[model samples]
Target: MRCKILIATDFSKAAASAADYALQMACLCRMNLAIVHIYSVVLPMVADGTMIFQDSLYDLAEADSLERLSALAAKLNLDADRLCGDGFKPFIEIFSAIGVPAAGIKSFFNRKDMGMIVMGIKPEERYAETLPGSTIRKLIKWASVPVLLVPMDFPPVPLRQIVFTSDFADSEIIALDFLAGIASAYHSDLLIFHNRISMEKGRLFLLKEKKFLDKVAQEIDYPKVFYRHKQKDTLEEALSVMEKNSEADMLAMVHKKHSIIGELFGGDKTLRMISRTQVPMIIFPQSFADIPGPARLGQNQLHD
Candidate 1:
């Protein structure tokens, strides 16, 4: 009945790992967890007396999916009283849908008012990169909420340190408000990381970036803030180094077109950085940051 964290799973090793990670996070935050599995229904070709066979097959598939879902929730201690039959089902909600994965996820979020969405990414092997699949890409593009991508092999760990990549865009302060709420929810420290390219005409860029962050400091009231600025050659290299050196449990970024992420999502460097990330990454779209609700902290208006 509390704020829910929706986790998409396919019962694969990677998805199960993501589910476990979500469970741990939900328990830590004292939030409810919703596990969803999307399955496709295939119809059989018409044949004499085959209608019965088709009906049986359909029933079998649904039953198998439900059984697997119940079994999965049992590990979390949800009994039949809470879910179904004799098992652990009360503590969590499991849904099986026969439709597009992204659409189902979106509908679930709207219905439940989910706090966040967690899904696993099976990083592509081409060029030895960790590129996300089309499903994840679509979900990130269309979902109106924060999407957390857990690498296939990510280990379970306490979310103690969270890093946010800042581009000094006007909407970034709005995004930071959401990120700060998450940091507070988990009792985690926040690190604002900025990687500066040397191509900026002289030192003016650094001065401008500094002044922007100073303005950020004045408007935000979060304690335990760490600011990191690095002069780097490429975005991929800088992000890889941060993951290596920061030991952060999660990374947060805003998805603004014409921003660094826009370039990363379009360029070859996306795979390079995705391959190197050792932690989960949470992306907030521009629309999500613009949502007008409790997150609309009435801070003094932001100015350049």
Candidate 2:
């Protein structure tokens, strides 16, 4: 996944902020970058002779988009050689990316070997609380590549601190392992936060997770280290508890294929959290292959 990065452009401040972050990340990570702007139109034609007029309109729109792309390319100071263009209409389908721009972006990222996708989460007058815009959330839902969602108005940081939630028992710490790997590479603090459900139950869950984490610790040490954010034992209180202490760069999660299904079908807290995430998140699918030999953790043992 080493292809040039893609930053979805809308020419808005929020979109430009995302572009700025992409440029900074590119320089820091030594990754190549691409700026993609998508324009879609629905043309209604009355007579067969209207084909010529519709073609002209399409060409004009495309030319305008390309001109904007060219201006952005210059503003970003990207050498003309590194700039590229990708244009498609309502007709093309990749990974079922029809009618949905986010799907198309995700499909593009996957097929291009792109390591990451970046976009802006637009802001509103309500700044204290932030939300991932509709399209951005859709991409988050679909993309496997790492994504950075810059807030329209929020400031960027070195991302020195990050928080990832885990009941600890969900899968293995494999999810945590991946996050820790990235956070470590950035020298960022890793905070594992999970709600404490009940006095005793939450405590026990904590203990259970800590035990698994210890096993993971044996496998890999974080001298830059780890912290357990014990929040109120209920979902309602969880975020408040975590927020009480400090802020984190990202809230990471795993789409334990089963967990995702349960959240969507079982209507659990994971679903609740998804609908009301205050921070941007990074989601990962479990792995490449599952063997039929045996089962490691029962679903009951893993529900968050």
Candidate 3:
């Protein structure tokens, strides 16, 4: 998995915050970074032929977008690959409308061995939605590699300490070495965490997860590693664990198909977990390996 870092931008100030965080992460990983902006002009209902064709506005947006990206690259002191692509629909739909920002990013970095993607999450604070963009959610769940999400207002700093959430999706994980290697690359302190509930089944599941981790520790020698299994059941309670630790620079998790807890709990649980984390979070797709399920892997109530 050798890929350069890719950061997509929209000239919004919130996006600028994400871009800054990406640069710091890129420098830490020492991976070549490519900053891209996908621009499109939507044809709104114009009463009459007020001006030029809708497509024409793309040029101005493109120019402004480029200037913004350039300024970011310069500020970061990074010589990154910069691009501005054209699309017919809004930027959010460009991915499914045709190819995607992910595909282009994959291909562009493929020649140079593109392997992972890092994107900005968090709504423009004014929007007040805690969820990520539909595009980002799709990519996080579907991307071939890891997609790291940075908060729109994350502080500028290095990603030296990482928290990898362990939901115990499987009895054994074959990728311990892979995870260890990546953690070692960044010289990061790997904090493995687990959230538990009072439910008997959930407790049993956590025990199995602990057993799996113990086996991994015995098999491979991972450095500077620590593990914490929280007895909290609610998402808010799980967040309290993060607040207690308060040392991770990023959050990492495997996107399980049927979270042992159910899709809604497994998924929303992570989102709520993210809500408490000040650092960026990276969701690793479950296809990578078999992990233990949480509590009710395939069952989720509307209230998850």
Candidate 1 lDDT, 181-254, residue by residue in tens: 66765778888888776665467886877787887788767786678877787766677776787657898877
> How many steric clashes does model 2 contain?
1
Error of model 1, residue 214, in angstroms: 3.3
The 10 consecutive residues of candidate 2 with the worst lDDT sum are 87-96
Ranking by TM-score: 1, 3, 2
**Steric collisions counted per model:** 6, 1, 17
Residue 211 lDDT in candidate 2: 85
1-304: candidate 2 lDDT, tens digit per residue: 2345577877789788777666654543435567777776567657865545667767776777777777876766542223222311011011211235776676576653454567766655124433335575566556655555565654544667777766565453655554555565467787776665555465676578678678767754565547565547565366645555557666666544434455446444433444444554555444411311111111111121
**Relative to the unseen true structure, what is the C-alpha lDDT of residue 212 in candidate 3, on a scale of 0 to 100?**
73
Clashing pairs in 1: 78-88, 78-89, 79-87, 79-88, 79-89, 82-90
Report how far off residue 49 is in candidate 1 (Å). Answer: 6.9
Question: Which prediction has the highest TM-score against the true structure?
Answer: 1
Model 2 ranges off by over 4 Å: 1-4, 42-52, 78-99, 124-134, 169-174, 199-207, 219-222, 233-236, 255-280, 285-304
List the candidate 3 regions with Cα displacement exceeding 4 Å: 44-55, 78-112, 123-130, 170-179, 199-207, 218-221, 258-267, 290-304
